[model samples]
Target: MDDVARLLKESWTLVEEHRDRLSGHFYARLFLLDPALRQLFPAEMTGQGDRILDAIVTAIQVVDDPESFEEYLRALGRDHRKYHVDAEHYATMGVALLDALRCTAGDGWNLTYDQAWRDAYGAISEKMLAGAAADGNPPFWHAEVLTHERYGQDTAVLTVRALQHPLPWRAGQYVSVEVPRHLPRVWRTYSVANAPNDDNVLEFHVRTPPGAGWVSGALVRRTKAGDLLRVAAPMGSMTVDRASERDILCVAGGVGLAPVKAMVEELTTWNRSRWVHVFYGARRAGDLYGLAGLRELMETHPWLSVTPACSEEPDFDGEHGDVSEVVARYGPWTNHDCYVSGSARMVRSTLRALAEDGVPPPHTRYDTFGDL
Candidate 1:
């Protein structure tokens, strides 16, 4: 095997040998070394430590494949951005990671092994920093709840007044919300429903996922006006590429409309004269939100078309079927850049159907809610 391959194999083996200790020590070292990061993490560091170790080990195992490694790392970097992790914090993480490796390797961890791992991590870090820079290192938003409107029985739409100058984010970018819950503060990511230029006020459409943890449940039950929620700078890659100049197809399922709503708003604002079609899916008519606003936009902007699809609400006006089916009927998708947002299952199935219907993968973008 090549030198790089051999080094990767050895690193993998070493990681496996000291998995438990490495996981434990890595976070311990991090927290002890950087009290700032410790503050950001959960008070129950044990569980968070395991998560960090699992993420790192998964990343390291994929390093031999550059393309996949880079993709994985980019996703990690994007996710971390929501946590407001800066380059300095990443440096601290790297140090902790290396120290854990050293402890795990014992006497066998010499200069050569250390150097190889260092080089690998340095490269990854550099790429991560570069990606963040390219994404326009957006500043964190300090927001106060302007109004919290209960939409349906279980959903709330929060209008926040941002304290900082807003960044130009595409639709589908999510903002991390830090709420003072039980303790240590808890963070959750919510998609922005309002368009980008709606600067002073940002809107979030949130639903109470059944059996969710204290953070989400509390937010649903207790969040009220005048409350402050720490928000991260907008971060996401699932954006409409306006440079394409191609027609656009937007698909949204349930609350998935949040991100797509942002995109559609942007499109309507930028090209009030351009034609775009939107397909929204929900189980029932009551489950659908923002249709009236979308219809208003369509009416005001002559170039826009809105199609609502209800799977269970058969009596609903407009389309009646799965979103993918509605999208197929509206083809040919090859002429448009298709944007999808919803649960992973819905996004995957919709994308697959779109591809099968001749929509190229490059022309399709998606944002899946919940855990990665």
Candidate 2:
């Protein structure tokens, strides 16, 4: 590899040992160097620390692959604009990031390593700046929650209307959400659950999972109509490649069904020749919140078939098993394009099943942040 890639690998390994402090140290340095940035982030630095470190780790993974790296960096930059990130903050942030690396690398840090980090950060900064400038897109969209309907104690369907701006997004992309009431500045990404509409209304299906109650609870339980929220730029690679004429197999687990639902909506509008089979699963029957919508799509689109599966509650189910297992039972999907979303474990399981059933890696699509 390249010097930047190799040096990053070395630096990353060392940094991982100090993972708990990496973001904290970096943010500390960032605020100290430029105190103005402190207002841009969340008041509670709880999960924020891990996010910065995760972003860095994600960047290092694809730096050797220029095309993948460029797309990721560009999307990352555009997403940062939601936080009011400016061109100048990049320099301060880069310096703080390098300081974190230097602290983590400690005795191992050298002139060569220093040069590599500078080069890497420089490249990252340049792409982010270019991404932020390439399209005159707004920093973030202001949306009002028109409806927050809860299907169960945990799941809610939110309809949000963007004000005076169009947030154009491809089916299957996701956007970050920030609740000003519950915890300002702390954001979580959620998939758009329906295809675009003239009403400028977007649907989001949210479920409050364990340990995610803070944000999810706010979204599903406390959020009410007329409540204001900030929506970040849409970014994802799992979107439909309309050019692909292959049949589709969509596997979704729990809230993973959100993006899959959007894809299905889009598919219904496309030429009906291509067939699609959707297998959606949840832990319990109550968690399978969108069966009514799926059924409606199936009735309207002759080429579409939906199978709702569940791992629990066997008494009155259509399909009974883990969704990955259910997908494998129906597969030999070598000729079909496969898309999977869900919890990290579920996504990994589904991919493994798809692989075992002869799906090619190239034919399987998911968001880079599929697990997150």
Best by lDDT: 2
lDDT of 1 by residue, 1-372 (tens): 135545856766866866778888888798889977876777755445555666667666768777767876775665566566788988999999899888877877778778777888887787777666666544355678888878767677888887765645556788777675343445666788877665567888877767544455556668899887777656666887767878888898877889888887777667844468889888888878778988988888888888999988868987988888888887888878888988777788789889888888878888876531
In model 1, how large is the Cα lDDT of residue 286? Answer: 83
The list of candidate 1 runs beyond 4 A from truth reads 1-37, 44-92, 95-119, 129-139, 164-168, 181-184
Over the stretch 1-372, how does candidate 2's per-residue lDDT look in tens digits? 477899888867877888877777898899999998999988888878877777888899989989989999999989988788887899999999889888877897888888888999899999988998886778888899999888877778999998878989989999988898888888888899999888888999887755673677799889999999989899888988889999999988878888899999887776578889999888778788888889988887889999988788878458898988989888789999899888888988888898898888999986433332
- RMSD values for the candidates in order, in angstroms, are 5.3, 1.8
Q: Which candidate number has the best TM-score?
A: 2
Candidate 1 residue-wise lDDT at 124 = 78
Model 2 alpha-carbon drift over 4 Å, by segment: 368-372
